[model samples]
Target chain A: MIQKIMFMNGYGVFVWFSFAITFVSCAIIYIKTLRTLKKYENEYAKELNKLSVSERKIVLKKSKVASQVFASYNKSF
Target chain B: MFDLINPSRVFSWIQKLINFINSIFFVVLMIALTFALIISPPDYLQSDSVRIMYVHVPSAWIALASFTAIAFFSVLSFIFKIKNLNLISKSIAPIGLLFTFLAIITGSLWGQPTWGTWWVWDARITSMVVLSFFYIILIVIHKLIEDEDKAYKAASIVAIIGSINIPIIKYSVDWWNTLHQPQSINLLKGTSSIHSSMLLPLMLMLLVLLLYCALIFLMKYKTEIIRIKKKNIKRL
Candidate 1:
């Protein structure tokens, strides 16, 4: 069974390597998008901190709502 | 009616649904790949090399589908003047481009073994290359035009215009005598030429890929909204 899969009648190299490359590309894209979301979230949080308390409260409330939506979105994964 | 719906709440619901789908996606993908590579019997003519169809066909299908989606959103954005629709198109472009690039590379890999050449200028292949160029152009337009509204308008126009190639790519196999095979899965006739074992894995992989695309699109769209919010905050 092992040898049959490995050989694939001499077509194994092309088939397996193509799948590997495709999956790796997908993984890279997923990681990159996740990192961008994290960076922006941190930056947005820092911006919120600089505001006065009352003003920050309103802004933070809106932000919280938005983040809650995204949290659910992320949880689905 | 539009104002009555809270965008955040809708987005939250979508995210939760995506999360559920993704959990299933990974498992289905693994089983599908194993079946495609190891369990399924080889073609009588093409032999084991036929395994490449599982990946190549799905990639090509999704690439074309993604572009069609971009064009669809672009039309909605133009008619409704909705900025979010434009943003959705923007977020989808990179993913569409990735799949187009994959289709080309895998096609080449498949071609070398079956067609005796790594590259060809056939109608089907050429139109796909044009589709990739359209993806690149859309991305570049976003970067070059700084004004948010202006960039959105320009990208939408490009997406709508470039959509002309989608049909060309679809019909190219029938329109011209090419080495590329005609459609294996036909919708109008409600039948497919491929064997059941081969078709099953192909369909599963296609589903998983499409789910993957949606996951990526949501992530990018969320990032875009956050960036817009950040800009609004800075202005105040």
Candidate 2:
């Protein structure tokens, strides 16, 4: 059974290659997108931190996305 | 109505959707793999090579659908001038391009054994290549153009023009004699040449890919939102 599954009647190479490429590509893109998202979030949080406390408070209150990024970024730390 | 889609309201939903997909994605993927690689019997003619269809078909479908969506949103943005829609088209472009590349590569893999060749510039294949180039140009438009509004307009125009090739890709097999086979599943005519056993795995794999697309789109869209906010921090 193992041999049959592996060889697939001499077509295993193509079968396996197709699956491998599709999945590995998906995984790579997923990791890249995730890293980019994290980097952006971190940068956004740091930008908020550059503001004065009152200004930061005002920004956070006015912008939910800003608050979310700041809160998530701080949580990561 | 527009207020409902405002960044803040949408931001909270992105978190929920991302968490939900992350929880379910792996389980669905495992099930899909089981069906695609093991449970589903090999084709009588194509044998194990048919397994490639599980991924190839879905990738092609996603690539075509993404470009269609980008075109739709692009045209709508042109009419209504909604900046938000541009973000959606932008988020979808990379995912589409990745799938387009996958389709071509996997199709080649499937081709070598089944068709006895790596590639032929058949109508369907050539048209799909055209679609991928369009995706590349759209992404480059976004990256090269510095002005946000200008970039969006340029990308939208490119998307609209690229969309003209979409129908050509779809009907190319019928329109021209090609090594590529005609579409086996037809939702419009409610017909499928593929058997149920194969169809089940194909659908399951599609579900997995769709979930993956959603996750990526959400993350990219969220990043875009944060980017806009970050740029206008002073106003905020």
Candidate 3:
């Protein structure tokens, strides 16, 4: 039964290859996109931290995205 | 209101949505894979190779749908001058490109056992290749053009023009005597030549892929928002 499922009547190569490629590609994209998102989130937090406390406070007050990103980035770490 | 889709509003939801999808994605994928590979009945004609349709068809559908969405949003952005819509289009382009290539590759894999050849310059296949090129051009434009406004304008034009090929891709199998089969599922007419057993797996796989696309798009969109915010931090 296991062998039958794997072989798929000798067409298994094509079938498995199709499914494998589709999934592998999806995984690669997922990882790369995740990495890029994390990098940007880190940068956003880092850039905000580069400022003095007063300036950081001003930014956090003015830009909701900066504050949210900084918080999210901290959560990740 | 446009405020409904503002990045600040959307950003809050992205993480929650990502976590939600991550929680459910693997389970859905396993179900889809089981049905697609082990449970679904094989074609009377094509045999076990028909399983490829579960992936190929969904990928093709997504590729086509993504481009249509990008083109529609591009036109809307140009008319409404909505920066958010442009960001949405930019995020969608890579996803479209990835699926287009997947469709072509899997179709080729499906072809070898069934068509006796890996590939042929059939009308449908060639048009899919063309669609992929359009996706590449759209991405390249965004990356190469330094000026944000110019990139979006150029991309909008390209998207608007590239959309013309969409219908061609859809009808290519019918219009030309291509080796590719005509569309089995037609949403407008509410018809499908495919059996329910096969359709179930196809739809399940589609759900899985759609969830995956959503996860990727949200991440990319979040990155774009952060990059913009980082650039503007000093000004803020």
Candidate 4:
């Protein structure tokens, strides 16, 4: 017990306390960022889920048609 | 190869270059921490307590550096209206605050041994405490405002205005007769008091901290960018 206390030298109070604060702060930031990212990803998946398969197919076809029109326009040039 | 002939090669080369730079940063950081821990001689007076300087000083250095980044990027964002730049600066705020707090705590720990006090209102300590407060204020400003554009603008303004304190903090020892020792590391003298063994580790610690700061900043910025991109895609 004496050796341990002397090792810390009463400065252990300060040193260990600081370390604790740093550890907790880092953990909080990491956890908060993780939760935020996961929440946003889940919300995005839900939004995508709202779209019916037929609607997505229609949107895909429209984009393909638009790209083809641009390609033909380049060919005419 | 020319950009017209091999765009993908150029893209791959850029990616490779970035990866190389990141790898170099990590290697240097690891080397620095190793030097500090294993190679550096202990202080004659404080002994192992001096080791804390390895972590403490560098954290403070990077804390200041991160704010410098935020200030520069905020200015760029304001001038260019680049969404990514704004997001990157905002994302870095909390990390900078964490480092600032860590530095202060470690400094206080060092002080209990060296100065016989855990806390003091010395110029360096007080200014560092104030710097932490400024970071918190910037974060609060970002959180309080609801509109993204307006919030970014407001946060950028706060970051820029708060940056005036950075120079003051750097020069506080010189400007005022303070309990804090004058900075030992200067371009003119180049750290005269410390032995080479000690200096090497300190330098290593500094290098590692700077690279770690960059890595964390980039990681956080990338995370924010992905979030923004997803938001934009959803809008479409």
DockQ per model, Cα:
0.54, 0.87, 0.88, 0.15
Better of 1 and 2 by TM-score: 2
Rank ordering of all candidates by DockQ, starting from the highest: 3, 2, 1, 4
Note the residue pairs that clash in candidate 4. B29-B208, B32-B204
lDDT of 3 by residue, B79-179 (tens): 99999999999999999999999999999999999989999999999999999999999999988999999999999999999999999999998898999
Q: Return the top candidate by DockQ.
A: 3
Report lDDT (CA) for all predictions: 0.84, 0.93, 0.93, 0.67
Q: Model 3's lDDT to the true fold?
A: 0.93
Q: How much DockQ does model 1 earn?
A: 0.54
B98: Cα error in model 4, Å: 0.3
Q: Per the 3 Å backbone cut-off, how many clashing residue pairs does candidate 2 have?
A: 0
* Candidate 1 A-chain TM-score: 0.77
Question: What is the Cα-based lDDT of residue B22 in candidate 1?
Answer: 73
lDDT of 3 at A14: 95
TM-score of chain B only, all predictions? 0.94, 0.99, 0.98, 0.83
**What TM-score against the true chain A does chain A of each candidate get?**
0.77, 0.94, 0.90, 0.62
Compose the digit string of candidate 1's lDDT tens values, residues A33-65. 989987876677666666778776666576654
Worst 10 contiguous positions by lDDT, candidate 4 chain A: A64-73
What lDDT does candidate 2 reach at residue A48? 90
> Candidate 4's residue-wise lDDT over B1-236, tens digit each?
12332222232243344366577975785677556645566677776567677767778887888788889888887887776677678878988998998898888788878888878897878888888988998788877987889989998888888788888888899999877777767757654676778877877777655555554554455456445544654333
RMSD of each: 3.0, 0.9, 0.9, 8.3
